[model samples]
Target: MLQTSPRCSLYLVTPLLSAAAANAFGEIFAEALEAAPVACALVRFVSGSEAHAAAIVAPLLRPARSADCALLIENDVRAAARLGADGVHVAGAGEDLAEAIKRLKPDRIVGAGSLSTRDEAMTAGEMGADYVMFGEPRGGAQTTGLASLVSLTERVAWWAEVFETPCVAFAQTIEAAGTLADAGADFVALGDAVWAASSPAAAVRDAQSVITRAGVGVP
Candidate 1:
């Protein structure tokens, strides 16, 4: 199997909070990212550019030569490559993921998102998904919020046990992120929980502390 470098200190999912959440979200995310001292900072972090979100975020990030950035889309793997994102997250709900992988080749890190189904997990693994992102895909139909959480997380667990693809678990809040680490998630995805904070630096520290307290080793 192919190897992924490993997880970073802050894995941030972008475009958080509609208008209300957007006001300061970007600044907070950048602030938190910078505060996580580069001396001990393991990595630059991960961001999802579903639509043209990458264009908006890329400028804000202006990632260093060493920074790591991923663009997670509903299905467009090619767009990710075009944008020069470090990785691409493909959802199982889309068309055959293998085809997407073929289009992307060895450049983009391909990850498949799941909501916890055995078949879906196996299919992703068989398709050679570089990483398996288990956790409910957030910010879609609002009604599915609560249910998507457990379903996605459980599937992440299953994928880890059954597939070669490593898993990243998404948590709605910092506390929940810690829970995911406890559950053995390889990497924890933090959305607005930390990004929307008044002090993104403090938020990163809070989440990292919780992750450490939960006994999950950071890469």
Candidate 2:
């Protein structure tokens, strides 16, 4: 999270984008984006029928696109393509990075996550991934799980120093955002830390302020 490197932006992720939750969540997401600049927002659906998940994402497209925020669907290429999403976040190392790229290539984004080691991360970069994320919650990927703060900071700093592929450091708290910034993370990802706040928009503003204070410029 070095303040001296390329400017870092926020990468937002929804708690769960289910059909029953889209309308209410969309309102909060729109408010957050309006309050601060975001690199992208992932419409995450944990577990559900594909049809149901697709229906859930349908209502969220308008708000994110209108704000000019890239909206990515988590771990679902079919939904990303069919729903006209900006891209796809291929969670965990178990997923096929190459196939995902091929499926969505030359147009949509394909970010690789669930990286627990430098080799896996570098491999993703070599595979033509748009970005590689670390410290994100894992979905039972044996290769790697979320790393500790010390480990995450080191990983981000290492990647920022050596690689051009942008790295995202998942920040569970405002303080963690600053720490990641100092470590040279290319982006700070906010998940439960924002949505669980009493005011989601205010939370984003606060997160942005933290990143700025750390000497990391925001886009």
Candidate 3:
């Protein structure tokens, strides 16, 4: 069995916003995160095509960070450690994940992102991932409906139980987030709904309340 960290946490996905507004959006999240209770902040640094994304994101990983993904460089792993970020997640298959695990400790949270198929998710689990980030269930076209959400959640939950690997639920809206939480998601990852709201902080606060009300509050 792959070793799982005690800090397998409540992962919060960063809200999507205009790249031109990324820094300011980050600040909004940073402030809300500082106040809102959560286990970690998952930033998509290297997910982009920037040379310094890791250097830019590592500082955010330290104090207020619990889990994370996409450390840009081998050097960035050191930064993650320095920042006291519990985990450094990797995305994709045959990705240089081994190098990351080798660089960080074995128990560090090294998550795999965007596994759209069971085979893909299982492969990630077998390779010793701390968690497998199942892609969003329903957010596009006819896919964005209550039925789709329920169906996808059931499938993801089944996989999580079978593999004993935690599932990270990414919701596009507030109601969707609540549904995921109530559906027994281990960690709920919400974005756009809160950050892009007219009142980012207020929206997040309401989200915090809803998550708590749904009995999904992180310890």
Question: Which candidate leads the pack in TM-score?
Answer: 2
Per-residue CA lDDT of model 3 for 140-202, tens digit only, reads: 222322236666577556765576777666666777666666665666666567656787667
TM-score of each: 0.71, 0.90, 0.70
Cα displacement (Å) at residue 141, model 1 = 7.6
How much does each candidate deviate from the true structure in C-alpha RMSD? 5.8, 3.9, 5.6
User: Which candidate order results from sorting by lDDT in descending order?
Assistant: 2, 3, 1
The residue-by-residue lDDT of candidate 2 on 1-219, one tens digit each, is 111235677888788656878778878888999898887887787576567876778777887778777888888898888889988888645547777898998789888887767888898888888888887743322235454677778888899899988888888777788889878888898888899899999999998888877763533
**Candidate 1, poorest ten consecutive residues by summed lDDT:** 37-46
Question: Model 3 Cα displacement at 110 (Å)?
Answer: 0.6
lDDT: which candidate is best?
A: 2
Mark the regions of model 1 whose C-alpha exceeds 4 Å error after superposition. 1-10, 16-27, 37-54, 64-74, 93-96, 140-153, 216-219
Residue 127 CA error for candidate 1 (Å)? 0.4
Worst 10 contiguous positions by lDDT, candidate 2:
137-146
Report the lDDT tens digits of candidate 1 across residue range 70-173.
43444556555665655566667347577778877576566776534666666776777776655543553212223555665565566556665666777778
Give candidate 2's error at residue 214 in angstroms: 1.5
TM-score order, best first, reads 2, 1, 3
